[model samples]
Target chain A: MNVIYTDNNATTQVAPEVLEEMLPYFSNQYGNPSSIHSFGGNVGKKIEEARSKIASLLGASSNEIVLTSCGTESDSTAILAALNSNPEKKHIVTTRVEHPAVKNLYEHLSRKGYRATFVPVDKDGNIDMEYLLKNLTGDTAMVSIMWANNETGVIFPIPEIAEEVKERGIVFHTDAVQAVGKIPINLAEVNVDMLSLSGHKLHAPKGVGVLYVRKGTKFSPFMIGGHQENGRRGGTENTASIIALGKAAELAAAHLDEENTRVKTLRDKLETELLKRVPNCIINGDRGNRLPNTTSIAFEYVEGESILMMMDQYGICASSGSACTSGSLEPSHVLRAMGVPFTAAHGSIRFSLSIYNTEEEIDFIIEKLPPIIERLRNMSPFWQEMKKKSA
Target chain B: MWDYTDKVKDHFLNPRNVGEIEDADGVGDVGSLACGDALKLFLKLDEHKRIKDAKFQTFGCASAIASSSALTEMIKGLTLEEAKKISNENIAEYLGGLPKEKMHCSVMGRDALEKAISHIKGEEEKKIEGEIVCECFGVTDREIERAVRENHLTSIKDVTDYVKAGGGCQNCHEKIQAIIDGILGVERPAKKEAPKLTNIQKIRLIEETLEREITPTLKKDGGDIALIDVDGDRVLVKLRGTCASCSKSELTLKHYVESKLRELVAPELEVEEVQ
Candidate 1:
């Protein structure tokens, strides 16, 4: 069975080019960059090159980029550094729809003597900017928000938000883990103080991430250890993955146009065809201001895990924001935060595409998915009740 | 992804009896859309009270649909009295075993079956027997206690996995713990004859009482307790962080700390502030 992988938001396939670029670092070039030997010193130069490539992709300075283990580390370092730099500020601001990386960290912070203000989102998953502005107080140490929602693929207005947050002297951070490669971001033009990007979200292997700290931003190290990442982040770098991330970043930059055009077209086609074929289904996010390669469709009355399982039978990989899929009692926080109806929230399926995805894959999914939804709906008591009510 | 059994996968992929029985003798619905899973069971009974046909319409995950399917198959030929003997464990065992978190799916099947049986007997639907313990899932104390006793659940998380009692806001965790303790017959305090206590013994008991009983309750409110000193019956302590800032720390110190110490150590034990 040919697997049609569409769960890119969860993680993407490591690009072959990225793997090839990283193999030498694991074997022949296996020198600790921290060592003073020439072999190690040469490896240090390669690390710098990788940093520059990643920096270029984000429109950031090479010195501003600090490589960490993953996006979660980058988020923790940024948020903690902001709070530590200004200890007098006891408050933090974030959106309610953040991925667990930011959401769970903020929840932990709230328990640890920090007042966290979770700004609400609209029904379309658009952030309430007025609520955000009102919550930005002198006591707010930082405002952390995501660039794009992983579940809904809804893009937040980061540039506008960053400018407003910066004007108030509040440190602004954006977890751009989902948006960095798929969307066009120029941190040179944006006023965000800190930005996080993960490797695996953009075709690089996992365990490598970049925290872009704007120049002149006050800093404190989260992982206090040996002077590495210029003491901004500590511990020996994940060398091979770092190199792979650099290659991935370069490819991402090159493929950015294709991502917006061809990938977006495929995603739109899949979403459109599914909606056309399947009745009583609704899209979960702002269709206009979303990532080019993602769609979250809720087949009302049917459960998401069942839909995902049925899709799995056909070798079509996807993900769900539903409760059963997450092992939680409620559906995805993103959907609930956006006030998606309970009827739809439990059945939301997210299809995130990547550059590797083809039109045939999308077509295959379009062909296979509607019947699955119809079958599940046929078995769903809620669906039957709904049909009767409508009748 | 859940590690579903092959039996579970087979049942889910090719679910049996997947529709409502028209003019059914008994019908039962359990769960809701808000809860992320629900099952509607329909039963057709013969003159001898044997199940002529059984069908289900389920809106849930693989295990839920599979459990519903399995239930219909299991109860098809059984008389109402025999069908009433089926348990959530029996349903789960039918499908090899459901993941612990997905155990509630099996429970849902059993609930629907019970309701269907009750409906056939023309009995009033079982009223929610106890106070609501988990507001998030609307799981009542009776429901939680029954699941705990039946499943032999040992932890709050296990109870949650079986019946979704303390799975939400978790404000009722302490209450759930009390209910579990009540069923398991584990005394919260060791009530042996009070032994003569050395200063060291008293201090150790105070620390143990604070760590075991008082700290967990305080920590739930984002507060903490520290044993500053233990001099005789007057257990001197300090509240930290949220506890220090909380205006109700006095009540916490008196009502919570003193009462716990009195019960666990001695009735005459007193707690006082060091700061």
Candidate 2:
């Protein structure tokens, strides 16, 4: 079956080029970057080169990049480092739409005596900038926000928020796992103190991530070990994945325009066709100011897991914000935060495109998805009542 | 990603007896849109009180739809009493099995059936069965107790799996656990004397035990395992992650895995490894 992969926000396929660049590091170049021996020292040089590639991608100095295990680790490192640096500050501010890496951590921190204010979002999945600005106080040690939401693909104004928070001398961080590769980010122009990004989201292998800490930012080690990553994040490097990430980052730099144009057109067509063909469905996020690759659509009276299963049979891969798939009793925090109604929230499906997605695949989904929704809606108990009432 | 059985996939892909039976003898609507899954069942009975026709309209995941379809299929041609005897487990069994978290889908099937039967019996709609326990899911205490009694659910998580009792904000987990303990305490004597676990029940127990009891511990040690097949008293499993490569993995299997399975699933069961 020809699998139409559209769940890039979940994780992406490792690009063949990225994978190729990484294979040599697994065995032939498997030496400790920390060791003083030339063989190991040669590996260290490759690490520096990889670091530069990542830094170049983000418009940052190589010294500012700290390699970690994954995005979650980078999130933990950034948030914890901010708090650890300013121990007196007892408050944290983050949006309700942050990925679990930040949101769950803030929740844990809330239980541990730190005051966490979860700023709300509008129905369009836009952050309530007023609430966020109002909540920033003298006691707030850190303000962590996501540059793009994983579920909704809603992009937050990271640079603007960063500037405001930095002006107030509050440590600012953004989980850019979704935004980094798909969007053009020249962090040298933004006032963010720290940024978190994962490798797998950008066609690199998993288990490797980067925490870009602005130079001279107050920091404490999350994984304290050997003097690796300039002691900001400490662990022996995930060499192959790190190398893969560098190549992926370089590719991302090259493909930024394609992401914005070709991928965006495919995404728009899927969104437009599905919305036109399907009834009682609405886009969950803002039509504008969202990541080019994502379209979160909610089909009322039908459930997301069923939609996904039917799509799976056609080799269509996507994700859902529905509670059934969430492994909880409530729908996604992102959707709920946006005040998306229960009718729509239960049926929300996020179709995230990538550079690999083709127009044929989009058209196939456009052709096939309407019937699936109609079938499920036909089986929905509410659909019967709704039709009867309308009649 | 739900690991739905092929039977479930078949039913979801091609659900049986869909749509409403207008002017039906009994109509039962259970669950709400807020809950993420809802079902409405329509039954037409023969003059002899046997189900002549059964149809359902369900709004839920694949398993929920499958479970509803399975219920409609299973209840047709059965007398009201025989149909009443069909439990949530029967609904799940009809589809081979459901993921533990998804057992509530089968419970939804059972709930819809009960509601339809109540309608046939002239029971009042919205007659609160018991005090609402899990405010989030709106699961009732009677429902929890009944699920526990029938399913032998041992923990708050089990209650959540069976009926979604504590699968929310978890504010009522303590109350749910209390209900579970109370039910288990009342049923302990009868349990020892009850019939031995059926193959389906035994497999469910082992899988639940693995998920609730053993998987977390193994995961803490950077390892995991999958139950391959159950052959009479022998349980086959494949160790994974750190456990797959560890020298003491065999010991881990015999001492940890076997003991845990024996304690929770069945005493006579043996653990074996398959390549």
- lDDT: which candidate is best? 1
lDDT of 1: 0.93
The alpha-carbon RMSD over the true interface for every model, in angstroms, is: 0.7, 0.8
Worst 10 residues of 2 chain A by lDDT: A226-235
Give candidate 2 misplaced runs (Cα > 4 Å). Answer: B186-275
The TM-score leader among the candidates is 1
| lDDT of model 2 at position A243 | 82
Best by DockQ: 1
Enumerate the chain B TM-scores of all models: 0.69, 0.66
Question: What stretches of model 1 exceed 4 Å from their correct place?
Answer: B189-275
How high is the lDDT of residue A1 in model 2?
Answer: 94
Q: Kindly list the per-residue Cα lDDT of model 1 for residues A210-251, writing each as its tens digit.
A: 899999999989888989998887788889999899999999
Candidate 2 lDDT, B1-275, residue by residue in tens: 77889999999889999987877889888899999999999999998999999999999999999999999999999998999999999888889999999999999999899889989988788677899999998888998999999998888888998888788789999788778878777443333554599999999999999999999999999999999999999999999999999999988999999998998778888898897
